[model samples]
Target: MVKGAFDGVTVLDFTQGVAGPHASMLLALHGADVIKIEPPEGDWGRALGELKGDHCAHSIAFNRGKRSIALDLKSPDGIAVVKKLAAKADVVMESFRPGVIGRLGFGYEDLKKINPKVVYCSISGFGQTGPYSKRPTVDGLIQAFSGMMVMNKMPDGTPWRQGMIAVDVTTGLYTFQALAPAIMRQFRFGEGCYIDSSLMRAAAAYQGAKLMEWVFSKGNPPVLYMPAGSYKTANGYIMLSAMRPHHFRLLFELIGREDIANDPDLQSHDNRIRNAAKIIKALNETMPQKTTEEWIEILQPKDVFCERVNNYTDYLQHPHVKATGAVDWIEQDGMGALPVANIPGLPRASEHPPQQYAPHIGENGPEILRELSYSAADIDAMLSRGGVRAPAPAVKAAD
Candidate 1:
């Protein structure tokens, strides 16, 4: 077997839902052994969205390449098992609210005492301290609070959440970036660090530029460049970004609006922004005369930045996307084929026909317990007492 970047790393993942799970999933993708510890009922994400047997699309998407071990943390024996696993793990991640894991007796402080070099990470809504630290929050609330929703408001001025969970997903990326560095520090200096990551913080970081603009301008982000938004065409909408002077000139020339292109008042960046309304009105009248494809054919050769606004289906079927191998087609049981996206910085050749299915609840409990040196009788006692779970017996097909 070939070794990967994180081949020797073991991760104790006590996270559920998107943010934390996604961070650990990235590590797993790079070859860390991520042991996902869940409740007896499984990660709550397994119950979210459309379901197929024990898993949902949400769970399946974020949990590839991890093993599930359902343990009742309320039980003393279960807590001991978790501590034992933590003792041997290179990284530990949890998404519980502030102090939740500490109450469960497995916070960074506790884990560090046993394993001083453990890279501990905590993901939450408001972070580990503050008046709102204990207040419950999710991705949508973060979007609203961090100015993302306002920045993405409709042209009619009605605020709406971004169609996807942007904050959670971005927070996952931030978490992974933080963890990778912490692991490096441990190797260089024998120091394990505690990371406090929050969706609110990630949202702010993601929208730093827009937030700065809004603050400086004291209003909505001004159109710095004319012809930089979506325009309706005869068949569909096409996004345009003819920001540079030469590109703007080419766009107008392609549309046969050289009068507007040659206007001296529209030449400089400031003048163009000042005349935004006039430039947009001209595009509104002229673009609808041709189809999006026709405009693309005319403008692409001129280097005017433009593309047809693509829905998910169009994106999946795009020739460039396919040629670049940006998605993995995995045949999941019951779910048929799933198009899993390939994360950047990983080998495309090694990404597909996903190495493992999202595990069932308690799917790896027996194997993990055996590694912990528990006897068969000891494992049976823990199972009987509801402290642990073994994978459900596979259903045999009828002869």
Candidate 2:
């Protein structure tokens, strides 16, 4: 059996985009019965994705352990349905713009009235009370606005957003942390509070060292001081992070050059900066004498740290990943094997298949209302009043 930690908690997840979804993804894996609340046409992801065999591959990957419910909160009937669902829910997560949910009558305050103990978490761009609270943001935009981009730019000076959505991941982890404490609060004191987690803020927090220096010292902390990043070798690049002075001494000695190591100008932090270019040039020249393998063999023996940067495919196929059983595979009807990256402790194989794909718009609307004990007449009335609309594609088997 797939044993989980959060076995009995019920989560009404209204999060979408990246960060919020990843936060709930972890909860679902740990056995929270997360009901994803999509709009009548479904979450924008299902429609706005790059498709593969039977679904949006990205959405399927991230939302593997949750159930879906399509609801149109713009309508009074739909909003009332949500209030009822939230009444029994232990947690409610929403990533809407600051005032959007309030205008729709499903804001944290409104939900709190229904369930005063609900751990309500709001994930947004800037936060609930900031000047940019309602600024529409995506991962790339926030990376730019938060200065994460500048910290990891190209040698030529053009900043780059990372290949994957880094800010989203940071924000998601923050959301999970916030929800955990709130859930613990409910268990300990019988009350839960709201968490205002902003993806922009989390991204900035992750890059605080670089950001703080720019704000306080007015420039980038030198590559020489932090001694962060890669050095080219005969065949590939090996990372170096000799942030401490003693380590710099050890690293210089390993490269077979102790002349500059104890030189008066390179002896201390301030002295190193006064002679930055010379130190960087000597290290670069010495690095290429050995391949990454040779450097690893030499430095690791002395405990002077270094690592080879691996690409995503390499990381997924690495020995540790396979040993940990970190990825799960499924067989689809016509498509070849689909691999779902499974977090540990979830049943690797089982009677229940991986969550069948993101639900079509309103595909589960009726069932969701019914689960909340809504009468058939009430559901029909809501539909008649435009509380929900089924996606035309869902009506047919294929799109």
Best by TM-score: 1
* CA deviation > 4 Å runs, candidate 1: 349-356, 393-399
Clashing pairs in 1: none
Each model's Cα RMSD: 2.4, 3.9
Per-residue lDDT of candidate 2, residues 129-227 (tens digit): 967888888888988887777777897889988988788878998888788878888978999798999987898788877776786776846654735
Tens-digit lDDT string for candidate 1 (278-306): 89899999999999999999998878899
lDDT (CA) per prediction: 0.86, 0.76
TM-score of each: 0.94, 0.81
List candidate 2 stretches off by more than 4 Å.
Answer: 1-3, 47-49, 53-57, 75-77, 209-220, 223-227, 244-246, 256-264, 324-367, 374-399
Q: Per-residue lDDT for 23 in model 2?
A: 90
